[model samples]
Target chain A: MDKLTPPVSGSRYSVIRAIIITWMTLVILGAFLLDIPRMNILEHTARNLYFHVPMWFTMMSMVLVSGIYSARHLASGSRITDIRARESARVAAVFGVMGLITGILWAKFTWYSGTSVWWNSDPRQSMAAIQLLIYGAYFFLRTTIDDNEKRGRIAAVYNLIAAATVPFLLYVLPRQMESLHPGADGNPAFSEITAPIMRAVFYPAVIGFIAIAWLLYRQRVRVAILKENLTSD
Target chain B: MRLHSGRTSWLRATVSVFLKDTRIEWRSRFGINLLVLFVLSSVFILVFALGQDTVERNVIAALYWIVIIFAATSSLGRSFISEEEGGTVLLLQTHVPGSAVFAGKLLFNLVLILIANVLASLAFTVFINATIANWPIFVVIVVLGSSGLAGATTILAAIIARTGNGGSLLPVLLLPILMPLLLSVVHAMIAALEPGSSWNDVGNDIATLVAYAGTVVTASVLLFDFVWKD
Candidate 1:
């Protein structure tokens, strides 16, 4: 394989801008077209699929990135790699919270009492809450340590260990517990017909969210580097 | 002075560390007393919250497990804090292998939890009239369940000791990881406690608890080197 050249950093903004615009257009168009189907569940609640599923997709994607970066840092002992890992975790947390909020809203509208509270022992809800708690502990662990090197190493190790548990908690354990969530047998959320339509907008939504989160991550890293530089000088 | 070498020396080191920790704890009286008091208070509070109504045995069994779990949290949190606060952990780290250190601490914790479990079980029996038809199975569940708890908590407490908000953050980090262990223990305990309930009823749960404990112990042993290095 030929060695790849890095893109010119400043010129990359045009690509990002195009991606953003394309995502917004597709989202607007998808919402407009979803009405043609007239499937009862897909009529009103289907709109949420575009937003909610993508949030979860992005969150999982970012978490995988975090784990990859963490493993890289552990193997290489690179500070930049550790920073990237930490930033991925932070971005994943943001998307995770969004996924959870959207899910609860969808639950209220679709499954819960139309007029009253709708909290039940649903496995999906329970496991989602547990996932949030696990990552919340991740951030808590990061902040509570004082030494930067120790913090990075500890958090990276923890990220990897905790990531291993997520699959079991989110998928395996819930199935064992017999959740009320649809698609336990096989989640129709990702069925062939729906999935194709989902991918039409979802792929871009994913790219868009990652780009947005990357931009934020870069900004935060720059600020942090500046603070360190100023303090040293 | 150079520490002793060889497998016999390692065993001796393990025993010494275990006895030293137990002796220090006995002298301090803080950990054991606090654990005992916390266990008693939690049982009383749970009993009061649940009330004396003849609720379904399953619900009672569930509630019983929750109380035991929360009580375990208190003792588990204390297991490492005392070492850290007194600087014993730093000294211990210098003298023992990571696996041996984990082993000694785990043994100490398992014994402490066993004592607490007995007291809590008695309190549960008196409060809920909980009847265990199979004493042997009941004992086995308690032993396996608490061993699982001790293994998981030892690793978590080690992690938490390095954190600033060690007290509060410990439970947040621990409880989620402990869920499967907690569920298995509760299921096994319910099977052992409920009238006419058989060991076969919780066979899967017991097997799971055994697997969880073995997996956690192995993982912690493998990971402790990385964890302790920093």
Candidate 2:
């Protein structure tokens, strides 16, 4: 709860960073090393359940964090809140792109093996791509304005507007259409299908990925604040 | 004048703004002309590009909505930019509440988009021989989808009006936000075109369209003050 103005170094921060790094390393090792129940097409690629799925969970968390910061920025008109919002969204966009690239690779070898189709227009995949576009638009809107305060206010407004549409775009519309992903069209969701052994790694992967996103966001916020301080002084 | 007035006056101000915009547009015919020309050109291009091949209902539905969306994007950004260009933004800001201004512009844009959509669909029918199997659901989708598009874009137009390249930024900002509504409407249109499809078939799409419109419009009203008062 200490002031994050100079969040560059602290014992607690270093401790948490150490833990996260060690934790993610274990998750990645377990992802490949663990023996998972195999299915016909999913096969060994089923281990992707640890890496690929967590990217989305982490991205979604970043979205929620960015949106909360955007709302707080609007309420308080504070540069700190604006910085948090922008940085969190930056992390969110990074995770979103990573999620997309991993999804394509995973889908290529498993679902479309031996075919030239990397993009099959799955509803969930398409929605993720659109979500990334929304983030792009948010960043693009920021660039169009010159005044820092004006940019913060207007970009905050736009970030909130775009976030408001995410639920419908990512969840509602995609559920209506058939998709290759699970949890669609009465297919068993992850919980129903995943063995309990896999859940051990899966849950921690989600946490580890989200924690990484948080660290990235914090780093960006600190850097931006320092830059602003240097420029204004 | 009280900045925060009773509901009656707020409604009156909203209507007055709508009427003023309507009167100006009536005289200038800019919005209508741009929309009509865009719709006609896109439909002509589709006809030429599509040729005599019988296209699937899904593709036709997609084309129909795509044309309408592009026409809207091309024309709707001008609503607030025109006010800025004429230097009436200050005059209007001094006179009306931001919420009322947004509502009025939303109403005007809704009407404009509705007209454009109807015109585009009619062109689809005439040029490509498209036919609607279910009139009731198709009309509902059109009304709800147009309102959703208008509601979402009106505030964006206001936001971009102050920026340097408002014209180019509108679609980039708009299309991503409009994707869900567009997909739902296109889905509903495809259902409506299927020979045996009924309201039951398009129920989710209708609900999505209505929800999309409600969410965007409500969010815009609450947020327009931030965008407008600056």
Candidate 3:
């Protein structure tokens, strides 16, 4: 009973891949091409709603995937489940980094312009960075444990505990303090539905990015399985 | 019948573990000694650096919490690390329920934190000449705040034991877990020590600290067995 063999052989997902490619192309086209209402200081970068925000949505989806796989890994003690958990976290981290960079770029030109401040210490920004650090510690923990199975179970428990922190960090902690970000706990949030035009591109952009992240996660898991099987043999 | 004794021994084992841990501390004063020294020196440093009565009440509260947190980081990982380093972890695992072991360690950490903070608070009052406008409110915040810190770190310490890396990794993992607890408690402490501050003013921050403490302890109970055994 080799653990790395596909639990079900030949799980092909090429068709879904094609659909994501097509949807993402359309979302990208709409994001830049669509005319958004002009606002003071925010001018045109508000279209970042389609790009920057979706990066988080996709990152969060991968985190949820990572958490589920971690839970299953503990229950079944399967290396494949462990690999899935690990790879998804790695990919989600990439997206999280991208989101942070893009958020900084967006803020620099708009909110912090003339002030030379890349980071204004906003609660939302600080907490999101901390959330990423929590996951970073998860990956770091994996490297410190040498035993394969022990690493899996321990990292899995840490993953569950880390996932428990996301809500408080991303949503709960930020809301507790005042911030420039819209829809903070203190402010009335901008309901995406009110602006039908931006919402049109925003929803698809979210779906498309999440779909792309799923593809990347699947590819990494496949490679991990082959490596694990080869080493065991 | 065996099940009944199993339950009884579980409670008894936890108390024994708690006793053994305190005795070990009493004998060696390993982490606790370091903590007490850390507390006093930091307070003395504060007095020397900031002139007498020149500091604001809120600043004093903040400084006290910072000292306590650093002191906690120095010692709170000892409960699990002591067992792991002594090679008694597996021995304990065989007899005591994981929950019982965690309960014992958590009890030890809680008492340790309470004593250390009270001593630190006293040092702050005497040496730093810190003022406390609301003693009862400040006490409530300190008790809840310390319990939360202790509970969160105990599980993390168990997790940290599995890693090959030495003690360096504990603080990295601990900071994020302690953020919300730290933020709310600092605010509550600030409010409690400020002149003319009332219960209504500090109520929300205190509530946040209580809620954070409650959730973290529940999480420790649920997650400790897996971390302890695996």
Which candidate comes out best when scored by lDDT? 2
Estimate every model's Cα lDDT from 0 to 1: 0.71, 0.87, 0.81
lDDT of 2 by residue, A170-216 (tens): 65655556788888767788688888889999999999999998888
Candidate ranking (TM-score, best to worst): 2, 3, 1
**Model 3 segments beyond 4 Å from truth?**
A6-12, A170-176, A185-188, A192-194, B1-7, B44-53
Clashing pairs in 1: none
Put down candidate 3 lDDT per residue, A119-163, tens digits, no spaces.
867786777687788888888888999899898998988888766
- CAPRI category for model 2: medium
lDDT (10s digit) by residue, model 1, range A30-125: 755744334544456766767776677777777888889888887877666777787777777888788788887877876663668556555666
Per-model TM-score versus the true fold: 0.86, 0.94, 0.92
**Top candidate by DockQ:** 2
Give the distance in Å from residue B143's predicted Cα in candidate 2 to where it truly belongs.
Answer: 1.0
Poorest 10 consecutive residues by lDDT, candidate 1 chain A:
A1-10
Better of 2 and 3 by lDDT: 2
Better of 1 and 2 by DockQ: 2
Sort all candidates by lDDT, best to worst: 2, 3, 1
